[model samples]
Target: MKIEYADRMRTVGEMGAWEPWLEFFVEGIRTQAAEAVAQTNDL
Candidate 1:
């Protein structure tokens, strides 16, 4: 997903914006993954 996003950003000449967006994107994914694991543990 990060690779795909980087490719798109590069194509659009927005490479500089990648870092901030990636930080936010990764945090969201991590939070969701943690929640999913917790739910599975509960089951």
Candidate 2:
């Protein structure tokens, strides 16, 4: 069972129409993404 990153990203894009769900999802994504980027950048 293997899925490509593009497919997963497209699935996430399809979910954007649901605002309530998108809020929580985006919140978590921002926090995690910031942490990941900060770790890499030594910020």
Candidate 3:
């Protein structure tokens, strides 16, 4: 599923109003990934 960011945003907008939710979702994923890496290094 290769889609451009703008395309994805458009689709999401079409589905419903969720811009903030999407932002939080991406941020959460990033934070979790960073935490995972840090924990692995601490081992």
TM-score top scorer: 1
Model 1, span 1-43: residue lDDT tens: 6786667567557546666666767887999999999999999
- Off-target runs (Cα >4 Å) in candidate 3 are 1-15
Query: By TM-score, is 1 or 2 better?
Result: 1
- Report lDDT (Cα) of residue 30, candidate 1: 97
Q: Which rank order by lDDT, best down to worst? A: 1, 3, 2
The full ranking of all candidates by TM-score, starting with the best, is: 1, 3, 2
User: Model 2 reaches what TM-score against the true structure?
Assistant: 0.47
> Which stretches in model 1 have alpha-carbon errors above 4 Å?
1-15
C-alpha TM-scores of all predictions = 0.62, 0.47, 0.57
Better of 1 and 2 by lDDT: 1
- 1-43: candidate 3 lDDT, tens digit per residue: 2344566667677886477557756887899999999999999
Clashes of each: 0, 0, 0
